[model samples]
Target: MTDTLLNHHDEGPTTAPPLLLGPSLGTSTALWDKVAPELSVTHRVIRWDLPGHGGSAADLIGPGATVADLARLVLALADSLGIDRFAYAGVSLGGAVGLQLAVHHPERLESLAVICSSAHFNGSKPWEERAETVRREGLAALADTANARWFTPGFTVPGLVEDHRTADPEAYAACCDALAAFDIRERLSSIGAPTLLIAGREDPATPPAHLREIADAVPGASLTEIAGASHLAPAERPEAVLAALRGHFDGYALRGMEVRRQVLGDEHVDRAQARQTPFTARFQDFISRYAWGEIWTDPTLARRERSVITLTALVAHGHYDELAMHVRAARRVGLTPEEIGAVLLQTAVYCGVPAANSAFAVAQRVLAEEDKTEG
Candidate 1:
């Protein structure tokens, strides 16, 4: 028998930001072992078992449960854990839940990363047929075909094969029912969370193009491909997948503390963080989630371009204190003093000399102070 969805295990620091990891169909939380530890370094990682897999038995997902229902179950699991807002990463079926979470509950997600997954899974007949097979004969009925699609030719994961063999038939079939009816291609643009779509070049399951459609629909979403890898890219190309995931999630400040330190100098960020009080807690959360998570982490623009834009906007708006702070960060991010001068000079031509003058003064002083400290 399967345990309730509430039985999902939690990992990483108790104080860290929450991250949910969902597994592919017929797999368990054990699918994430290679990747979870790396993420847990800065996040409270939850390895979620798929319904009817591992400890979560088939009975938990009776008839009428869709991916949306599975998504709701994950949310309920979060609520049970006291995590109001969290980040998510998943593969295939797990990734489908991530998609539903992004589209339906944007406010609840800090960031979303989907690997070897698709917006539509291409067709419903195959899934429906698979669901029927499992219902009639059990998980063994579908393991051979599933195992083939999940890995590259001739390279097998015995553990995952074992996982497929052990999954509860009713639960596996129920999840297939969710996949068969799942189609959100038309609604992809509505997703607001930062998204990373990864695909395997050799994957016959949900090929690169399936992920590409999603990448095109979701604004600012990025697509990465792994050469020579199949459906289970996260398992097949573990290191590459981990690197891409870390960069994507970290950029959003899901581990915002470290990302903030990297972008804004540790001493300055530390001071601001230490200054937080009950009155300013919400404001702090806003900056961490929006500024760091949404804006700074955006993959559409290079960090240097983001810095240039921030410096330019600050100059235009006369946010002098923020201008000063960003001036320091701009330098750390590789904007030279001469380049900074060029921005102010350009600002003077259109934004007017007064705005430019104040920015010029701030940038010069900040840069000079750095020179003195280094000396």
Candidate 2:
């Protein structure tokens, strides 16, 4: 648990919330290739390989292994990266591990997504048989069969097939062994994190019924079933998968940029966006997500009301640059110059005449510039 994990593939702003992407049994983190790029836009996407898959070494699995053991490895991976809390989405065995984390490490996960996974996995006998077959005949024994079960007919993935073909038999078998004793149906209701279950209609490996079981058990959980998709919905129907993911991580960014653009005007927002570089990216994301998304998007008060308060505070605090920006934004969101002048007049009484005087000067300059540009 203390040892640091290696070769974790990460994307997006470090300031964004951490999002863990897990793969099915025998598959590497490559399973999420189709879904990660779009999702990274709203999150710090962290994808890792299972023990013995891809760049990951099989050091965690052994006799009597369970999903709990795999879950601990996931936690250790997060800990090594200094991620205390994260949203998780996984496929098959990875989804089971997500469920395990939601059950045991509830506080550590912000949200849970179980894709093409099950609670009992049909009592593990199927898993044990698969494990024994791989142990005796090696990876090929399961690869040929698992490939078909993983994807619908007429859809073949060479890289995914190669992943199963090259995986260590023992490690792959150990993963199956972990599934042998896994069952958490009773613990479903105890999960507090928001949960989403995605099922593939054609996936005989773990169909809609399995995801339904999870949805019905977990409080406030929802289910989505994709037609014509087998176990690999993210790969088969990438757009649909991305849509579901965007919906799941919707709050991470909180739709703040839209409001910011609406309030500040497109030209102002375009300039702010153009100014972003690697050094300022995280700060920009922070302001956009929290300041714009959380605060600006709040419906408790209208944008105009918030604008008046913001303009007044900026003027009172002597933040002339910000006050100027809000003054323009206030005009954009429909506050007339007279209304803005009244707010500044009120600010003069409480925050002092000098502050209001300076604010008026800044506002006058911005308004004159706007008129000149229009003309």
Candidate 3:
């Protein structure tokens, strides 16, 4: 293990907006090679290998390690790099980690985008069994099985197949453990950051049903499913994945900037810019233009209404970090705490009581903070 923290391999201008990327299970940062260049045109991209996978050290937290550990590690990586906040885009296990981060560390994320992922991975027994096999045998044993879910039948490329085959076996097993234990289905509604959920229509591993479950659980979560792609949507259908991420970040960045200006005022924005450190400056323009500009200026809905809708959606879907932010935004938009509670209670019936139960806890904390600030 390298004592030094992981560093991002940058493609474009160092000053562009930063996007920290998490790769799929069992693969290295190279998984993003084809997609990162296109995204790098406008954003500074960071692609890193997960611990015990790729170029990173081979120490596992054992089968007992939770997905939250991955989330915390990623966050630690960001902190080590001096990133206060940045956009996050993840695939499968990576996406699940992103969701957890958005819920638990809202202040550290500007936006989140998940592709070919699910909020829960509990019911898939065969998949778990196969993973255990890889843990014992190696990745080669599951080559055919992994390939089928990763790419569409008609579009198979020999090179891509080889890439999948050569992946680290222990890393793959570790990821399987991460996925098997993942059960954030009940907590999707509490994520407060703007989110984009992309799925492959033909994906068998994480079917469209699971995607719908995620969308429905996270309030205001926008979903787009690629018709021909399967589980490895990023690799099999890079163009679609790139376009969705670009559009999402563009929209989210715009909305966030507008809100910052409104709340912090123009002078504050300017003063913040004047005093901006290199680390913080990387995200300033991108956040202002995209998150605040596009999302905030859209005439389709008012900020307050959007806030309420977003909060309701997250609560219904179970994304707590984003849920917390929107709850705060709901207050800023004039929604009463009671109204927010109503949304959670209503979501309980539609999304389930477990989700609602967790959402209510986040709501209470958010409301309490608001009350303290006012008092």
- Per-prediction count of colliding residue pairs? 3, 0, 42
Q: Against the true structure, what is each candidate's TM-score?
A: 0.69, 0.76, 0.65
| TM-score of decoy 1 | 0.69
* lDDT for position 260 in model 3: 73
The 0-to-1 C-alpha lDDT of every candidate, in the order given, reads 0.85, 0.86, 0.76
Tell me the deviation in Å of residue 63 in model 3. Answer: 3.1
Better of 1 and 3 by lDDT: 1
C-alpha lDDT of residue 127 in model 2: 81
Residue range 220-312, candidate 1, lDDT tens digits: 999999987898877778888888887887644555556678899889888998999999976776677657876677689988899999889
For model 3, how does the per-residue alpha-carbon lDDT over 37-108 read when each residue is reduced to its tens digit? 978867778887766665565463445467887887787777776677889999888899898898888898
Show where candidate 2 strays beyond 4 Å. 1-7, 253-291, 294-325, 328-375
Candidate 2 Cα RMSD (Å): 7.0
Worst 10 residues of 1 by lDDT: 1-10
- What is the Å distance of residue 41 in model 2 from its true position? 1.3
> Model 2's lDDT to the true fold?
0.86
